[model samples]
Target: MSEKMEVDTPTTAATEEKKAEHVTPSASGESAAEHPDMKLAQAIHKAVLMSSNKIPMDTAHIDTLKADLIKMSNPSLIESLASPLQWDLSTVDIAGMKTANETTLNELEEKVKEAQENAGDMEVLEARIAVAQFAAKSMSKKEALAMYQLVLDLPKLSSGKQMDALMEQSRVCSFYSDTLKNKDYIAKISKLAEESGDWDRRNRLKVYTALQNILTRDMKTAASLLIDCIATFSCTELCSYPNFILYTMMTNILYLPRTDLKAKIIDGSEILSVKDDVMPVFTLVKCLYDCDYKGYLQAMVEVESVLLADRFLFPHAGYIMRELHVLGYKQFLDSYKSVTLTSMAQSFGVSVDFLDVQLSRFIAAGRLTAKIDKFGGVVETNRPDLKNAQYRDMIQQGDLLLNRIQKLARVVDV
Candidate 1:
């Protein structure tokens, strides 16, 4: 009788385990329920989902992105992910998604509870992290953020786990264009990565910081960071390698000295690798480097089209274009003491009057060190003398030092 009861107990437990495996309904024939790693699934789904929001250039691209999102989001929480897009219900099994969402959440909650009851502290933390990642992928932004914060608040969390949570939070903030929160999260991640000596995370943070700086119009800092990461860029979460190179080219072309631009960008292998993929941007840089003013202006139009179409670069399109023109004009003027307005205008593929007005505005604003001779129909360069500038700076610093010394003497006397 005892032997018979033991056999029956084993059979009953096996049956229940098999039934539990099938509890979560699979949506659209995808097997997300069977996937062991929720983070992997989330990363795959997020790559497509976040990209759809960033590349809103054309209707065709938008439609394509939406389709990809729908395909990847299946078997997870499709309804919440697709609800904002107002996608057609006929394409997805809406009823099945509701069941799947409920089942997945219930299963995750059970895992967390089970870990707390019987497992060690690390196991409980892992279970909670899984729940948080699932919420990030399937739930609304508010709920997802709350879940992540819960995981972060857990005691004895390692630096790596903390960084992982903060990075996911940064992605959520980025999706909503919550720049302030995203910046704060990245700063926290930066500090943690530095403390833990996580070189990969540190490198990835450079790209993240560069994107924020670009959006904020801090081109000098953005340009430096972007240029530095060209050879070791691994932040595919933010953009593709080709698109990363495009950004590097665009920002560096505006701020880098000719020698540095030539060495770091124009001659760099990474930029050359993607030259064909981003021809207009490549042309913009090449023409500027080669002093091909006419081609540079023509390429600027094409590059501007791309900039205006991009969601990230659109806001600063006008500013970037103006700066590029200023750079080109300044470079052209540097080679000669003076050049005729008609000749300079012809070189830049612009009208004399238009170039005159443009150069006048730049000169008046102190952006360009040149004088527009309306009477002589020439533009004279006023390049500052390095020696005289250095002398003036030294004298100013010396006077300031003497004032500081005099103040120190007065304090000593007192």
Candidate 2:
């Protein structure tokens, strides 16, 4: 009986060992479930399920929820969270809204082509057309332009509708740099703005045109238009750059005479709120205002790479630098009819030859009616008599007109 029990014990022990092996896997799984990463994943899962029960009605919240889920740093788990959010009933409702928007878009297609013989729907049509145009613009320019043309060609739009369409078209045309197209669009929009009699709309359109010119790096036109815009706009309008149009206007205007816009300019608080790259610009503006030539030059040098990399300011940057030189000389010479070149150079902290070259440019451009008395080493200002200057200008213009008339007559004779 003892021998039989010993043999049975070996078989029982082997069976017990087999059971231990099977239970070890289940024990290891339990240990893994206690791991920090696993615990975190489970916590995230519970959070998501809770959130799903009280999901936000707003679609914008969906992005926030997705962002929260991605923070878990577990690819397998992220996939699980992503899958549920993808087809969540809330998102499904968004798809329904999109379908309804598509139907509105189709109706807009017909409404744009035919005048609703009903005046009642005209206001609603305008609103719907605006929404449709924005959608089409995002999808394709060709489609947007067709809609724009339909609105523009409409013979009898309300001043309000015309203003809306013109503003939209002006803004859209700015995406392209075609001179002819921009000019044509500007002409049409300007006409519409004029007929609307809304001074603010006209001013805003000028600013829009100026911004397009800036994007094209046509600084002269941009500057001219911006100056006109500044005149038309209130001090409040020029204070901050809420739009690219305003931003370019304000930054570039810093280089111009600021006597009129002193209070209207962006301040230190405003500069701090802007980009680090723009800090150099504000610094340059300060240097300019303080008449700190050396500081201004250094600021420009510090930002030269930035200027070249920037599309709007790059083309005119070198010109602005030269303008600084001219401005320094002009301010220093504002009191002097004639001063020794060396003395002027010393006052402005520049070399005699350098000063001469800069002054020569101003003289040649007729900006400064002055002559370099090389022998006397003095710059003599040619103070023109106002009446005589006007007389000379009139004669020069008359001569140009006469020459054009003669050429036309000669062509006619032939």
Candidate 3:
């Protein structure tokens, strides 16, 4: 054994502290079956060897070791140290050696990070799979769609499984008429419907899915399918768009002016005359075109269960639908706040000056209150107590406009 060896180097404070705690016992008590003088000699020898070389032992570490050694009584450790075994310092040197380029190691470390990220994605995929399975088993199309979306997002997921889950969600959602957030899912199902070759189901699904795609503003997909879907199926029972569909899509002047679908509106005018069932939808459509916010909101209330999907008139119409459906009073307040003279004028498709004059007449007749702002504009507040008498007189006089509303009601296609 060498009298002095520079074998160990401290890399960290904790390592240095551990070395001090374990080092002194190996040095001071280096012999057993020896007299006090011999033990003292061994301690001195260790002290000389340790002091001869600057090994960087911390004083704080040394003091801690000294205190610990006072309590421990393990003599065999001293005997073994007296005839100290040779340490394979080669192994320690190998451990201490590192790559020259810290950058290269950092790059390798980044690869390891990427692998961990992939592993996390795999876990997410697994979770999605589990959720999908649960949703399918429970027949919860909405929940399944949510899970399928997660599965579709993972780039590494098996395409076969992704497609399978997607199809499953699509089938269930179509059957239940559940809405999905992803356009791809809708497209996939529409294609499936086309391939399956069921005329009624396929055509309906195609139109519904196309509408869903439209709801997301994927106009290219919608345009691609609209003409084909309309041609493929008759709209007699299902009311597929630009024809029998009495929902909010045709409620705008933009829809009315479309030449390709103009005859459908004229047909709708006829449909209005047949049994008067479509009145609610026609009225809503008119309100939408007129931007009669309050009237539209009020009309929504007369319909039972606004939560019913078919009754959900607007496709992604936002708070306009939500407040009217779930919080009517709040929507009422918002409508009142949004009202202005220009709004009323635009609603009637007339000049602001003309509307103001009409409003002033109503105010003078005590049928409405003319709230004139300092900036020179008026808001009409209809008073039922005063207006009821006028409404009765109008009813008796058989006002042509009121008669038209009644006639529209007679042809209302519910």
Candidate 4:
């Protein structure tokens, strides 16, 4: 899907205005700086900036981050939101921000009181939501979280309103990189979305759940969720459409079976739509599916650059790269009962010694069903017998079931 596609219309006026102000893509398209979640955008820029101190980044990229940081740093917002990151805020107007925050809160308090007195419950709720949103956007993190809770606590809130409040809370958690709290909020949102049967919100919840899973390093679950939502993604508040596809390809590449990878990702229309925009990732997946080991290796380097530069993917870059190598080797080895180590290394454009050491590590870890013979200079594939494997699994599970049943009988006798 195109990033600019009108996936879902806002249901309420407040939601419409919110999208107009924050989520709408600019004419130049949605860049990181143009992300709807301001706090997440700030956090990403700050993360990249800090990573620069340890990793050598090009001057242009560093310059862009610095500029984006300055643009996103709001003095009136939470002061300590970026504290954990230890990002320099010298250029930000800390004192003026504090003053502005106090003034805004006092004004909002008066509005809430007026609404409560003269207007109906709905008006009061709307006023309170405004206060909470303001807090989320411009006040301290503690105050923002508290305000959102207040909105959620208000009685007679519709399912839609509850979902909105929960989503806002999730965004706040994400801004602070609170993965645990973010996951909790996502769970709440998921329940509400299902209860309401709001298809738009349900689609959005898939993206939210996928992102939370990614943060928790549950790549298999994340990949499943992302792949399922490829055609229905409408969560521009979290990320652009192209980026969503990029994430889908990245996570699925690590765990998806070859057939599913070929069907869903290799030939999926949604993925093909943004292939040019995310060419590196697409290239990596294509090379692996096509069994072009040399091409896959070359493409992996480019893909690694993209992964290392991403705030979400940076921590997992090394692991993902290593897994990709194992995946390539396992797929290649699957085609043959035994391939000479020299030939395998040559196909991957790597040295035989490097391939030998790499395969040995994975083999010992039980990640690959293969053995390497240093003396014979050959690698033997040990493909498991499917029926035998399933039978053994059933036996193990049956034993556990019997043990549980015996324990239950003893308790009954007691």
Instruction: After the best TM-score superposition of candidate 4, give how far the Cα of residue 313 lies from its true spot, in angstroms.
Output: 1.7
Give the winner by lDDT.
Answer: 4
Consecutive 10-residue window with the lowest summed lDDT within model 1: 1-10
lDDT of 4 by residue, 131-207 (tens): 88777666656778799899888776666667777877887776666888888899898876654535566777788
Name model 1 segments beyond 4 Å from true.
1-58, 65-103
Ten-residue stretch with the least lDDT total in model 3? 24-33
Clashing pairs in 1: none
- Stretches > 4 Å off in candidate 4: 1-51, 58-73, 76-91, 398-414
Model 1 deviation from the true structure expressed as Cα RMSD, one decimal place: 11.7
Ten residues in a row with the worst lDDT in model 4?
24-33
Question: Which parts of model 2 are misplaced by more than 4 Å?
Answer: 1-140, 153-156, 197-200, 212-258, 261-285, 300-310, 318-320, 340-353, 372-382, 385-414
What are the lDDT figures for the candidates, one per model? 0.73, 0.52, 0.42, 0.75
Taking all chains together, each candidate's TM-score versus the true structure is 0.78, 0.52, 0.30, 0.83
RMSD (Cα, Å) of model 2: 28.0
Better of 1 and 4 by TM-score: 4
Error of 4 at 183 (Å): 1.4
Worst 10 residues of 2 by lDDT: 1-10
Task: Please estimate how well model 3 matches the true structure, expressed as its whole-model Cα lDDT.
Answer: 0.42
Query: What lDDT tens digits, residue by residue, belong to model 3 across residues 270-340?
Result: 44453145455455545543456456555665432221223223344443344233232222223563357
